[model samples]
Target: MPRIVDRDLEALRETALRMGSLAEAIVAKSLRALATADPLLCKEVQEDDLEIDRLDVAIDAAVLELLATKAPVATDLRFVLATKSVATDLERVGDLARNIAKSAARLAAAPRIELPGKLDQLAGECTRLLRRALDCYADGDPERARRVLDQDDLIDASESRVIRDAIAEIAAHPELSSQEIDLILIAKNLERVADHATNIAEDVILIAEARNLKHREKLERAGDRRT
Candidate 1:
């Protein structure tokens, strides 16, 4: 049964990684399509979302099977739950990319709006955070996961700046108000995508150590006070 268990575990890992990679590619390619307004790339993202949905279905089945057969406990149990949770966030992120792609499709014929400076930087930050989060998951490294969660605020701030600028642009140019609004929504969707990636990182940290790293600083402070 040891060999069987090992094979099951490997299968679980492979499925999760495949799903995560698809989600990551969606974010990366969607951002590029957004930045460049390349119709071909946007169409690629549209097709990629279908692949993500397919993987989600496949991974979900693998997870349920593992639980039924492996009956993992303690850290392994936590890993199973965390895998489910991360897959959920990744699925949502995939949807967000698809939404952006759909929106881009609508604007394909409309004039290309250059992604604002803050939005561009936010996309760059998200790409890095997502890459690191996936690395942490594969290696079971809590420290790298925590770092991704810590850097989330920077992306959030950039998101806020874009919102403000978008509002200003719409107010200043009433004629392009509709166009400005669509771009604004796209930027917000990307910001939320980053947030979901951070959630995955946090989930990884919690699973790898069988401890909640959430509010970690507060927990440390409380320990100090008790001591």
Candidate 2:
């Protein structure tokens, strides 16, 4: 039974990795569509998101089954729980990618609007953070997961700058209000993508160290406020 459980857990990891890969590709394609304003690419991203959603459901069922039947304990239980958490984060990443693609499609019909370089930077940061988070999961490296947390602040700062620039653009040229709004939405989506990546990294930490780092972070924030 132990051997069978180990085999099943390996299979679960493989399935979860496949789901992660698909989610990453969707995010990459969504960014490309945003840069090019291609409606067809946007449609493709939406189609891929459906597959991601299906995988999320399948992974959740597998995790639950393993828990009920295998009765995983210690490290094995951590692996199961982490797989579930990562799947959820990946699914939400897919949703955010779809939202960005939809915004791209909406802007495709309008006059070409120049996207800020910072917007591109933010997108690149988001993709990099996500890839690193997945690497942490693959290697069970909490240090790498900690590094992923650091990258989130960079993306967040970029989002703020882009948002400010977008608002300014809208104020200067009211006729380009739609384009500016799309830029704002794109920045917001990219920020959300980074957030989900951070969640995956946190899950990796939880799996590796058996520490509730998120709760610790909340406590630290509370302490900061009191101080």
Candidate 3:
């Protein structure tokens, strides 16, 4: 029975990691759509979101089954719970990626306007954060997970600057307001993706160190040094 439970747990973890990879691909494709303004790629992102949703439901079911059957305790229990949390965050990341793709679709329709360079940089940074967070999970490395937490501040600062620049451009050219709105939304989605990545990294830390970092007052100071 113990051996069977161990195999089930391993399968659950693998499925969740596969789900993470899909979500990461969504982020990458969404960014590519924004850069290329390709309608087909944007449509692909929307389609892929459905698969991510299905994986989310499957992960939840697997975890609940483990809880009911295996009755995991202590560290094992924490691992299962943290896996659920990470899956939730990754689903949200998929949603954000779809939103970014939707905005890119809108941008494609509007008059051609060069997207901000900072927007490109922000997308790259946020993607890196997501990738590293997933790596931390696979390796169960809290130290590497902490490094992902450190990256959140940089993404936040980049997001702020992107928003500021978009606002300024809109003010200068009111006629291009539609494209500007899309640009702002894209930047917002990228920021939200970074946030989801941070959430996943925090969960990784919790699973590895057995320390619940959520709602800790001191850790709030970590966001102070933006970039």
Candidate 4:
């Protein structure tokens, strides 16, 4: 016979996966909204965000209840803690998606920016990073999480290149001057989404090691300052 604790653990895993899927959906929809400037798609993204917020609240309540009632220790405690962190990251991801959608909605009536191929490539990279990071967090696969982090540099570079081209286009074409700012902002939003994916990967590493690497670079900078 399975213990209630065992059942609860299984439920926790399911809930975490659900949250991840919701986040992934948001990412995909946001990209569609960006690419198409479709008001309907943007509206869908906005509507989906309510569910993500609800899940975040429900997950937080469930995790808190488990902690208070179960007194979980060691690996169990780690799982619950990691789950809470994942929920937060997922919620933020949803918010980013909503922001992108809203921006697309605002630009709906304007002439399309005709983003270069590099923008599509950057978005694809971000989508991959987000999907992999979500999987890693869902399955507690630290290796996959690390790979997601490794891929972020490529996305960042691509974002920079696209933004540079957009800026140049704006300078060369005065007619596009008005929409360029929005396009640049959208590129920045996508870049930030990649950054959030990196944070999720870091959280996975932290959950596995019980050590925080988040400030590792900052610490190095501080050491250099002292030196």
Candidate 5:
């Protein structure tokens, strides 16, 4: 027989996972819309965001309820706290996807220009990172979450390359400056999505290991590490 608090915690986990899955799908759809230049798909991404927002509210309520009524401590407390942060990150990821979709729609109206640099590759990597981060959360695998953290730097570099390439393109073809600007914005939104994914991965590590690795690099440099 499970306690009520245990059941509630499991329910909260399920809700978080559901929200994460929806967010991941929204990101993929937004990227597809950008690649195919489909305004209809852009609208769909916007519509999906409402659901993400709702889930975020629900998760917040649940977290508050658990804290006020359940008195969760130790690992349970960490899980609840981390889930709240994860929900916030996922909600922002949804917003970033919507922003990308809007930029895609705008680009669709303008004359087609070759996307500068490895924009497509960057989009793919960001989406993959998001999916993997969610998977680590679901599995409660701190080791795998740490790996996801390591991949953020790669996505950051890719975004920087895209921006540089788009700047060069704008300089070369001043007439297409508007479209180039949109491309830069889309690249930035994708980079933000990757950032949210990394944050979620960090939360997963916190939940599983009871260790705060968000500032792991600085701690390592200063040799102030504690296990």
Candidate 6:
């Protein structure tokens, strides 16, 4: 029975990894659509999101079944719980990617405005962060997950720069406000992708170290008060 349970857990991990890969691909393709203003690419991203939604539901059901039948404990329990959390984050990443794709589709019909370089940089960083987070989850490496956490600030900073530049462009050319607003929405969606990646990394750390990094800052402040 123990051997069978272990095998089932491994299967769940593989399924979660596959879902993560699909989510990453969707985000990358959405960014490409945004860059080229390709309505076809945006359509592809929207179609891919349906698969992500299916996978999310499948993972949740698997987790529940595993818990009901096997009653996993200790490390196995952590892995099962983390898989659910990671799946949820990946689902949200897919939704954000779809939102970006929608914005890209709008931009496709509008007059092309010169997008800020910072937006490109932010897109690249968010993609890299998400990939790294998935890698850490696959490897069960808390250290690599921590590195993903460290790079999230870079995404936030780049997003801020993109927003500031887009706002300035809108102010200077009010006639272009619609297109500029679409660009701003794309940047916001990309930033949210980075946030979901951060959440996945935090879950990876929980699975590996049994330490919840999600509330580390708040917990640390509380501890300081006690001291």
In candidate 1, which residue ranges exceed 4 Å CA deviation?
Answer: 1-4, 213-227
CA RMSD per model (angstroms): 3.5, 2.5, 3.6, 3.1, 2.3, 2.1
- What's each prediction's TM-score? 0.87, 0.94, 0.93, 0.90, 0.93, 0.94
Q: Per-residue lDDT of 57-114 in model 2, one digit per residue for the tens? A: 9999998888777788888898899899889989999999999998899889888888
Question: What alpha-carbon RMSD in Å does predicted model 6 have with respect to the real structure?
Answer: 2.1
Residue 80 local lDDT, model 4:
80
lDDT of each: 0.79, 0.88, 0.87, 0.80, 0.91, 0.89
Give the per-residue lDDT digits (tens) of candidate 1, residues 1-227. 22135566667767778888999888888777766678898889988888888877887887887777667887777887788877887888898988887667666667766667787787788777778888888888998888888887788888888889989998898776777777778878878887787878888877877766555667787884321
Clashing pairs in 3: none
Q: Write the per-residue lDDT of candidate 6 for residues 33-116, one digit (tens) a residue.
A: 988889999999989999999999999999988888788888889999999999999999999999999998998898887767
Better of 1 and 6 by lDDT: 6
Q: Write the per-residue lDDT of candidate 4 for residues 57-162, one digit (tens) a residue.
A: 9889989888888888777777787778778888988888888887788778788767578877887888788888877776778888888878877887888898
Output the better candidate (2/3) by TM-score: 2
Against the true structure, candidate 3 reaches a TM-score of 0.93
Better of 4 and 5 by lDDT: 5
lDDT value, residue 218 of candidate 6: 75
By TM-score, is 2 or 4 better?
2
Model 4 stretches with alpha carbons more than 4 Å out = 1-4, 224-227
**Residue-pair clashes, model 4:** 0
